[model samples]
Target: MTVISIPGSKSVTARALFLAAAANGSSTLLRPLSSDDSEGFAAGLTGLGYEVVREPDRWYLTGRPCGPAAGEADIYCRDGATTARFLPALAAAGHGSYRFDASAQMRRRPLAPLTEALRTLGVDLRHEDAEGHHPLRIEAAGIKGGELTLDAGESSQYLTALLMLGPLTREGLRITVTDLVSAPYIEITLAMMRSFGVEVTRGGPGNTVFTVPPGGYRATTYAIEPDASTASYFFAAAALTGSEVTVPGLGQGALQGDLRFVDVLRRMGAEVHTTADATTVRSTGGLTGITVNMRDISDTMPTLAGIAPFASGPVRIEDVGNTRVKECDRLEACARNLRRMGITVATGPDWIEITPGTPRPTEVETHGDHRIVMSFAVTALRTPGITYDDPGCVRKTFPGFHEAFAGFAEILDRRGPATRP
Candidate 1:
């Protein structure tokens, strides 16, 4: 088994950057992710008058506890959904005037839920391009910070953004989350806030009511874990192929909830192990399909769905309608791409059913979404001759994914790079 050192968590790094930016003093992030998304996040902070210094293996940033120094700033979010979603709340909390822009495709994504929530919080956010989507113009007067009703069914990022601003509110905040999806991410958000020195009062994944008293975050040095979402590719590779892969710096106690993707693999009869310092995945033989609802760990839906065609039975994934609003319509994208490769995929509004088939050689349309590229690459491990379009989109979260996955291929002594034409 090759022990791979995965990069730091994109989710954690993004959240950490904002928390550090709003902290009372300087906070150092040890082993933070270096990618387009995190870079965009740091750059967004820099534009808001926070100091961000990048060094080998770490990042150091100073807080803007008094809110952004600039009265106006432009944020180039590119394709980072986290950066796009989270920063708006930060802007509202800081009372900074800002304009956020993204890639052409990202402009089509729905931001109305969060934007509307911000409006409810008394932050003036308008759609500068089209109505109800990015690019948005934020004329921040700071949050009114009372009870706000939010629909997180579209994205937990909406709740995450608001939850992050809970402590910064003048009168604090009471959030009522309805139709919440990706609930585990809320847990990660609360945990990270606790590390930065504030506790978010979690009401329920059952009945989602959250209370945040007006207590601000303190500056603290933090260490980020390896990206568990990215790790799912390797885990799925192990399940699809009869080989073993281990990711160091991730384990049972990791902060990222996407680590639960391994639990799905284990359920599918993959050999999975977790110790204090590392997690390992090794194939037993072939996978047996089971129905899965991916709302909590929905990021791995494509990854798991990629490998399902080779399973013994039908694999059903559900409760991820939010995927439709991601970097692309991931549910539809997976069905289209998998069917492109001669696999049988039945897709519904919020679920997909993939049955066993001999996957044929074909090109995967990534729709410029990184998860699409990475997920299909896992399928390529078992079913060869899979080439993907817009492979560079992995830069959004995992910039070195091609290089790392190439090493993954070499370690297993498998076929050539998934990028080969």
Candidate 2:
């Protein structure tokens, strides 16, 4: 078995940063993910008057717990969806005249819903040239925090952001979310919030109502879990190469919903086992294709998509309509890239069906989305001759992706594309 050290969870790191900034005192985040996305979150927090000290194993912070400076707060998310969605709610809970922007790609994503929700709570939000995207400004007056209802159809981060803001509001908040997708991610948000000594109540008539009282987060030390979504790519490597791979520090007790991706692998004829400290995926035989709804674990849909051509039948990915608004149009990107590999692909408003065939040697266009880049990299294990025009796009989350993946491939490729047709 090859051993791999996965990075800390991106979801946990972002939530930790937010909670730490919202806490009344100082806090330490142990083993937070160090990536462009995470760094973007850190920068956004710093712009809001929080002081963040980055170290190798952990990050230290001095919480403002209130708001940014009075005049202007300019924060750039640099294309991280979590940062773009979560931070606005954070600012609204505090005090400021804040301006938020992102990379051109992120500007194309949906921020209107979150902005509109914030406005419902009395944020003076203004669109800067564009109607519903970034480069938007908000005069943050600290949320009045009343009962409200909104659509969570575009992204669950909207709900997660609002839920994070629940405790900070003056009157707390009662939010009813309709058309919710990726509900498990909200669980991650709630779990990390609890680690920060705050609680969000979720038992109501429709189960759609979440209540968070006026008490904000407490300053505390929190440990981050390994990135299960990132680990999924490695697990996909095992399934593709008929090798066994183990990702330590990620197991049954993990806070990430994407850890259930192993079950998806197990359903596809891979042998998966979990322990207190790690999750292991051992290749049983050939990869089998099946119909899967990736809404709950949408982050790994691209990983599964990359391996679909190696399976014997068609693989259908459903309920991932939200992915259209991610770092890129993931559905369309996958469809285009799979076609470039000489495979068959079908797409709908919320699904993709991939047919197995031998792939052609072609340079993949990453669209600068880290998931798109990393997922397609896995195909090189079975298909070989696969290359990317810009492999460094994985730096968005996994900065050392190329070197790490090369090492794993070296170990697995000692046998070279096992059981390939």
Candidate 3:
């Protein structure tokens, strides 16, 4: 069996940086992701005068529980949504003038929900450009947080930002969320908060209310898990090529919701085995397709779409409308790229359906979305001559994705179908 080592979780690394910067003592992060997004976040922290020392395998951050040391700063968030949404809230908890901006792609994504919630909590936040978009300036006089209502149907990062900002507030915070998507990501945030020595309680109907107590975070050493979303491409490649691929560091105790993408592979007629610390996928036989709701794990929708044409039946992905506001409209991007491959595809407001067919090699228009490039790379495994418009975009999450994936493909190809046991 071929085993691949994926990079550290981008989501976990970003959240850890935020927590480490806001904690009481210094924090050491092990195996933190080193990519454009994580690097951008660390740089943003430094821009705000937070001390961050980067080593090859560990990152050390000195917390200023009071907030950023810089009195005034300009932070460019790059394409990281977490950086754009969470950093502003982190800055608001301090006393300063901080202006945040991002790449054209991230600037197109909405920041209104989080910014509005911060404003509701008495933060003087203003959008320098279009209202609800980035290029925001926060006149931070510190927050005396209280109760607020939020609608997080578009992006859960809004609620996550508010929740992380809770302990930094004088009175703490009680947030009542009206609508939420990607509920599992919130669970990760809560679990990570607990690890940082903060306990967040949930109550009200359907656990819609989150109560974050005052007395900010306590620093601790945290280890990041391998990225499950990135692993989805490998799992999909295994299913498509009838190979047995095992990925360590993502088993039962893993925190990422995207790990559920393995279940989708199982449903598609792949044999999957899970141990305490690793998960393996082997294509038992030919593939079969089914409909799946990806609301909580929608990031892997493109991975599923990439290999959908190889299945015997149509594959339908639903309840991922929030994907529209990501780095790009992922639903449309998936549908568009699949069509370019001469495969039949369709998309609605929040879903995409793929009909089985033999895919023709074509240049995939990545739309500068990392996921688009990675997902279609798996598709390229089965269909040669496939190329990408911007393969370097994978640097956003996995900087060495091409080399890693190509290595995995080479091993599998040399072994042939006999690689399956």
TM per candidate: 0.95, 0.97, 0.98
Candidate 1: where is the Cα deviation over 4 Å?
204-207, 414-421
For model 3 the local lDDT of residue 349 reads: 94
| Winning candidate number (TM-score) | 3
Q: Using lDDT, rank the candidates from best to worst.
A: 3, 2, 1
- Tell me the lDDT of model 2 at 322: 85
Question: For model 3, how does the per-residue alpha-carbon lDDT over 1-421 read when each residue is reduced to its tens digit?
Answer: 8898999999999999999999999999999999999999999999999999999899999999999999999999999999999999999999999999999999999988898899899999999999999899999999999999999999899999999999999999999999999998998999999999999999999999999999999999999999999999999888888889999999999999999999999998899998999999998537788999999999999999998988889999999999998999999999988898889998899989999987899989998999999999988887888999999999999999999998998987897743222
Summarize candidate 1's per-residue lDDT along 1-421 as a digit string, tens digits. Answer: 7688788999999999988987888999999999988998888888877899999788998887667878899988888888889887887887668999988887888888888888887888789878888888989876658998888888888888888888877888898887788888888888999998887776766658998877678999999999999999988887777777899888878887788898898998888889998999887547888899898899999998888887889999998888988888999999998888888889899999998887887888999999999998887776668888688989888888988887787776653322210
TM-score of 1: 0.95
RMSD of 3: 1.5
Question: 1-421, model 2: which lDDT tens digit per residue?
Answer: 9889999988889888988888888899999999999999998888777789999999998776565543478889897988988888888776668888998988888888788888888889998968888888888778778988878877888888888888888889898877788778888988888888778888667788888888777899989888999999999999888899999999778888899988888988899989999999998448888999899899899999999998878999999998887888899999999998899999999999999898887888888889988898888877678888788888888999989998999997676558764
In order of TM-score, best first, we have: 3, 2, 1
Model 3: clashing residue pairs? none
Leading candidate by lDDT: 3
